[model samples]
Target: MRALHIITGLGVGGAEQQLRLLLRHLPADCDVVTLTNPGAVADGLAADGVRVVHLGMGGNRDLAALPRLVRVIRAGGYDLVHTHLYRACVYGRLAARVAGVRAVVATEHSLGDSQMEGRRLTAGVRALYLASERLGSATVAVSEAVAERLKRWGVPAPRIEVVPNGIELDRFRFDRERRTRTRRRLGLPEGAFVVGGVGRLARGKRFDVLVHALARLPEDHWLLLVGGGPEEHVLRRTAHEAGVAGRVLFTGERPCAPDGSPGPDLPSLTSAMDLLASPSAEEAFGLAAVEALASGLPVLYTSCPAIEDLPAAAATDARRVRGGPEAYARAIAEVRAAGPGPRTAPPAAHHYSITRSTARLMDVYAAALAGSSPSLAPLGASPS
Candidate 1:
């Protein structure tokens, strides 16, 4: 089967990373097409021998690039088209219809209730997204919270499917020696405790809360902020103002697991940490938190819907804090004192592993190809 996956930019993010994982694990007989210009994840996908079609979409809402996408989908003769992110979901579905593809599916990776720049603009986008839902043969949501939000926004329940995000367990497994090496390479003291946070330095991520929480922690505590965004400077200033600037390390957007060589740098980075902190006010699925748990590190996150949907064991390691700095600081101290428990293996490997998740995704593709209607099962229902 030929599958075409569409996404906005190939920048490093949870959705983009998951797309690459799906492409890499798809069956050898399945042809995978990725539509995005060369970026961080492109090289990784290409390295896996996945055919990538770069449309050079400058940014979201590129009307000019629609023809190129439509043309490519037609020429590739894709049996199924799966799209991620808002822009790709909208344009990819429309283009797939234009290309006469048999099935078109989209994965909703964010909550629909989020307010963009202005109320009017947000409403318009929501309307457009709702309309696009009709074109999709099926709609997949990374979390139940996200699916519920879509239903509340007027999407038909039959078209929605809740598929929790998955990870590569082998890649994120606990490794003591690798942790030691990573800490040593990063110049961190062996005895120091590291709390890592990975996400864009944006408003929704709430990096300021993390910086403030770090300020309240003991001097021995360290914070590692991985990922980049427009708010990097603002977050740095917040740390400086909070007097914890020296304690925090900002490693801007590291290259993703390009060659998949156990990604010593990426996995080691998460493993070296004693815990992961996700202060985001919004998240469709906490992929980073799951990665941390897989690496045997507990996580402390905000009381967001997405984090709440994590498995009970994984959620137990997570402390839900309010948005303010003081609440975050208290939660940090509590988690630090608790230390990380023995890494509880998450549910079935299929629930979160790339190989399993991609197989389940193929089932969705098969149903779509057969023209079977979509079904919205309960939060944890098996895709099979």
Candidate 2:
């Protein structure tokens, strides 16, 4: 089936990167339209022979662009329109309806009661979201936590589907050679204890908390911040004020490759890390933590819905520590004392593999096209 994927921006964030990965596995002829700033992800999509359209949306209030979006959807003869992130969900769903597309679906990649995309949650935003949501055939939540959150947001239970984000396990598998090379490339000393976190450096990500925690660690401990955002200067200042400025390394924004063959390979970076931290209280699925686990690195996270939901065997390497710099410091020390377990694939790896997620998403597409309205069953198993 012909599908059009719509997203807020093509920047290097979790949702954007996930869309790039999903395209690699989906068999349907799919194209992407970025609402604004078709950044790095757009180039990657174009490299893979997928068309990337820039809508040039002026701002959130650019309702005037809806007719143009509708025209494009209609002219493309798209059988399905799949929207990602918030703005795209709102506008794309409306456009799809206006274009008379047979089916429209959206992936709620990031949402919580407190915030979305680092912005404080407000009633007006919820009203806008719900109003646009009604136009789509289905809304896919990235985790069970997100699904329940949507329900609490007033969406009918039948309209929310759980489809956990997936990772390409083979790409993230531990490789000593890559560890050596990536560490060398990043100028990290061979014996330093490196703790890394991957995602946009946004306020909601709570990367500032990681800086404070790093300051509490031993002298040999270092921090690696990946991805870039408007908060970089603030985070850098936080690092300086924490007295760990010299110990902190920022890799700027790294392009995530679906096969991990090009750009700054995420798996390689994960390999270079001694530990992975996800201090964000707003994480939806924590794909980076899962990739770290797949890379055989122990993870310290404040919030990880998919990891928490995973069966114990599958999540043996992840720990959900209490929020605070001290708690994270203690968790890091404890993990260091225990050292790492045998390096092997976590038992739960297969469940979150790209192969399985792709199949489940295809099922959602098929269901949407079947004119299944109102009641929709959740896909993906509840974490065991």
Candidate 3:
């Protein structure tokens, strides 16, 4: 089927990178439209031979982009339109309908309890989201947590499909050779125990918690933050204040996986780490933790529906820690004392494989085209 994917921007964030990965695996003749900045991800799409159009939207209030998007959709004669992120969902769904596409699907990549994509959930935001959500045939939630959040926000259960974010299993598989090279490249000490936190450097991500947690650990326990944002300076300041500034290494936004880019890819960075820690109390899918598990690293997270949804036996190395820096410090110490296990992905990682997600998405597309909502499995049940 001919399809078009719309997103707020093609940057290095999880949703943007997920879109790039999905496009590679999806069988449809697909193209992409970014409502604003077409950054590295846009270039990556171009390299992959995918058509990407930047809408040049001035801001959320840019009305001119509506007609421009409609024209693009109409000209493409796409059978279906899939939207990602917030602004694109609200505007892309309407434009696709106006352009005469009957099937429209939107993926809610980040819909937390109090915020959606770092924006506070104001009344108007909910009204707009609910109103525009009706324009799409189905809303795909990245996890059961997000799906439940959508339900609480008044989205009908039947219209929401839980299609978890997926990872390329082979790409994340542990490699001893890669581990040595990556650690050397990052200037990590030979015997240092690296703790990783991956995501936008946003306040909500609570990366500062990791910085503080690092201070409580031994000098050899280092913190490697992968991603960049407003919190970069704040986190750096926190690290310096904690007197672990030299221990904290920030590699400004790296691609999902090496897209033949200059810097090291995420997989290489994962290879360099001893443990992955996500202190964010709020998480939709907890994608970073899942990727770490794929790399066979023990994970310490506060909230991760990806791990929580799976059977405990499936992810034995993942542990959930509560409270603040003290809790994280103790957990990190315990995991370190336990020493590293075999670097092999668990069953949980295979469950969320990229190819599996593509097949499930194709099912959602078929259901949308057939003019019916996709049936959901039991809340805790594994998706078939």
List, in order, the clash count of every candidate structure: 2, 0, 0
Put down candidate 3 lDDT per residue, 264-299, tens digits, no spaces: 387889999999999998998998998999999999
Give per-residue CA lDDT, model 1, range 1-384, as digits (tens): 877888876766667777777666677343334455557677666776777777877666567777787778777777888888777888888888777788888988766356422123377788998887788888998778788888888888987887777777877777889888888877887688888988777777888877888888889989999888889999888888889888888888776654463222467788788888888766767777777767767777773454576556545566666667788777777777876677554553225676667777778777888884442211221111
**lDDT tens readout by residue for model 2, 1-384:** 999999999877778878988998898999999999998888888988899999999999997778778877877999999999999999998788777788899999989769876667799999999988888888999999899899999998987888889888988888889889988988887688899988888887898888998899898898999888889999999999999999999988867544644334788788889999999887788888888888888888988888877777777888888778988888888988897666566866667998889999999999899975542222222111
**TM-score: which is higher, 2 or 3?**
3
lDDT of each: 0.73, 0.85, 0.90
RMSD of each: 5.9, 5.7, 5.9
Error of 3 at 307 (Å): 0.9
TM-score of each: 0.88, 0.93, 0.95
Model 1's alpha-carbon lDDT is: 0.73
Candidates, ranked, lDDT: 3, 2, 1
Candidates sorted by TM-score, best first = 3, 2, 1
Span of 10 residues, lowest total lDDT, candidate 1:
375-384
Error of 1 at 65 (Å): 2.4
The number of the candidate with the highest TM-score is 3
Clashing pairs in 2: none
